[model samples]
Target chain A: MAVDTKKCVGCADCVVACQTENNVPHGFCRDWIVENVKGTYPSLDMKFQSERCNQCENAPCVRCCPTGASHIVEGGIVLVTHDDCIGCGACVEACPYDARYIHPQGYVDKCTFCIQRVDKGQNPACVDVCPTYCLHFGDLDDPNSDVSKALKNRSWYVLAPEAGTEPQLYYLR
Target chain B: MKEELMVSGKHIAEIYPVLHLWHWEISLYLFLGGLAGGILFFAAYFFIIGKEKEMSTTVKWATFIAPLALMIGLSSLLYDLHHKLYFWRLFTTVRFTSPMSWGAWTLLIIFPLSIIWVASFMKDMFPNWNWKWKYLNQFESFVIKYRLPFAWILMFLSIILAVYTGILLSAFNARPLWNVSILGPLFLVSGFSTGLATSMWLSKNDAERRILSRIDIFFILTELFLIIHLFMGFMAGTAVKLEAFRLFMGGSFTISFWIFVVLLGLIFPVTLEILELNGYHVPKWVPPLLILFGGLMFRFVMVDAGQITRFLY
Candidate 1:
């Protein structure tokens, strides 16, 4: 997604909005901002990159799950079925990004990208509520789509691509 | 770091390295491979003595149980592979130099031999089946009767498979902590000791105790010697290679290795074994528990400590 950091105030309205919408816990977060603080008192640069599940096209978590509990949907969205989960934590351990969590109910859990809402006509809770309009999701297969357009134009990187996970999330620098 | 605290990370502590979830297959393999070593020790004892009735059902049990363990173990390993269909390739091309290849071929041989050996002794023990397999059953009996020489060959091979697993882990030169010349001896020591303990538990009679306890002592001394040799090699090797020793001396596994592996697995077991040998009252079960505990703890400590040390770089 084209996250114009100059526009993000780091206010975390998206965080609160997301928790209430998805019933996410307080201490743990579906999404987070990593700030690399540099320099002494005289000089400083607070570089920020908001992070969450990459929802890979070629996901290790999906391949590792023997029961197919943690899997990829038709939209290439990484999805987990709570009922089928054996709480083996194989997916959690396999993820290089450490995106998966052992939910309180004892199953692999991660950012769904609001699969239910995105399945319908509505955008994801975080995407809809972001004050900066920084979050973007669209059909990568359709080059005309905004995400694919950004991909064509911008210099971007995916997390741990060496893993062959082919994460869908992208950062435009 | 707490003194009691050990390296407890994903293959390593204080780092994030790529790791595969240890499948049930691997776990079962470790257990089964170890069991094969234990059983083979007894098989050798039985064969050299040259009597079926002389040895307890434990020999027979160990004969049959060894393969059962291998089958379960191999199944798990088969399940863990990236390409399960190509497992036949393990045997189709046997590289004698590669321990893994040797292991696969050995499993192919060991499994059938174990069953045959057990069935040979079991033919009269178990009631004859009402259903007959035509000429095959008589041929099977004939093969079993003449299978004594092959049984010895299988025994030696099975023992090698058990110990070779340790060598397999040690072969990873990138993993310097495990890369030691003494690995083969170390594994052999533990395998023999565990085997003696296992037989001691199920077998009866003074002669069995006397012979196994002697073998047990020999193994304990040999194992201790190998551990020292492995440490000396690491210490004398380059500092980069000796990163594992630093971990051994100062890192998390210092206690687990010194205490669980050394004290409980070796010293206590050896002490009890000696007492039993000297005619002091010692339960048959005590030695097995200590020996088994030591072998398993050694694997755990070795695996965890080795991985963590590799991550330090």
Candidate 2:
């Protein structure tokens, strides 16, 4: 998923969509908009970056999970199965972007990119609900996919990329 | 000057180095939990072998006090924050990228689990409690049925909490003092030694002391390897990070690391454990004092040396 800051209006509808689709409990958020507020008094640049489970290529959540509840499935999605989790919350703490959360049911919950829908060949609920069309989801491996194309042309950065998470999600500045 | 400092100068990135403070908090938690886990494991050993009578009334205190102390010590960490509510936020999220998150999750999980596990042995210790409750009488049966499994869990969490606390520090890429992989294993060993010593000192049973001393030997040998490995890793780290080693070797912390953590924590206890194994049962005070003192010293030096960091950032 690639986020276009130019397109995002800080609506945070995508965050709500990810939460609702993933059954993220109240008080725990799987996605966040880092409102980088700059400048005081007048010339303010409040940059809202939508952050979630990056589904990193070198995902630490996968490595630190004791129960194997957190792992990267096919389609470049880092998915978590709550039923299998003991709610150790290692995945929540391991995400550098603070994307994962301990759901009320006592398990690590995060953005699956609506894997259930994507598995059925439907778009992610977040991408669908997004008003500004900032959140782009598609195959990065396929050069022609919207994610791939936009990423190729845009100036982008992933949160804590140096942490070796290799998050699939990136932001277009 | 005050206005410049108050504004968002370059100071945001250079402010008091919050990450280092986080690491220091984690390291202190490691030491405290490690000691708590160690001492609890010692008490569990006595229970497993049914050396209850051999254990003095002190062992019970050791069991009860250590975890309570650990709970208190671990709590001190949250107050060091700008907002205490944010610390509780740790439990609300599970980010695997931050060891603090992992530590928070693990501590929350293990803390209660340990409390329950230890409660079984404790309820009986508190005979003066109101016997009015119907289930109070059957507490014995409740404990008997689940004691072993709970004890096992206590040990498992003990190891996980102790070792992972070390792993928590080492997980960071920036701090050289904590980046060693051996820290996890070493901490477990140190924790066990510390626990055994605490149990032994609190225990009044000569026979229980004998058994604990034997176990001490086993953990002592393992700790030596882990300490060596930790040093080797520190030596191999980048020059900037290698300050961890210098703190132990060339700095003021050298004496504490060498005398207390090494001699008292590792060597002396092992030496005493060996004597008991050979012909003579070493003096009752010998091993336990060494272990406890050593463990505390390790923590003290770490806390002191870490504050001396001069990061090249």
Which has the greatest TM-score? 1
**Over 4 Å off in model 2, which ranges?**
A1-173, B1-28, B45-61, B122-129, B135-141, B237-243, B272-283, B303-313
DockQ, all candidates in order: 0.04, 0.04
Clashing pairs in 1: B25-B76
Span of 10 residues, lowest total lDDT, candidate 2 chain B: B2-11
TM-score of each: 0.60, 0.58
Worst 10 residues of 2 chain A by lDDT: A88-97
> Model 2, A8-126: lDDT tens per residue?
87777877787678776655566666556655545666577776667888877777665456778877788876655655444544455545555545555677888889888788988
How far off is residue B88 in model 2, in Å? 2.9
TM-score of 1: 0.60
Which CAPRI tier for candidate 2?
incorrect
Candidate 1 Cα lDDT to native: 0.67
Candidate-wise lDDT, in order? 0.67, 0.67
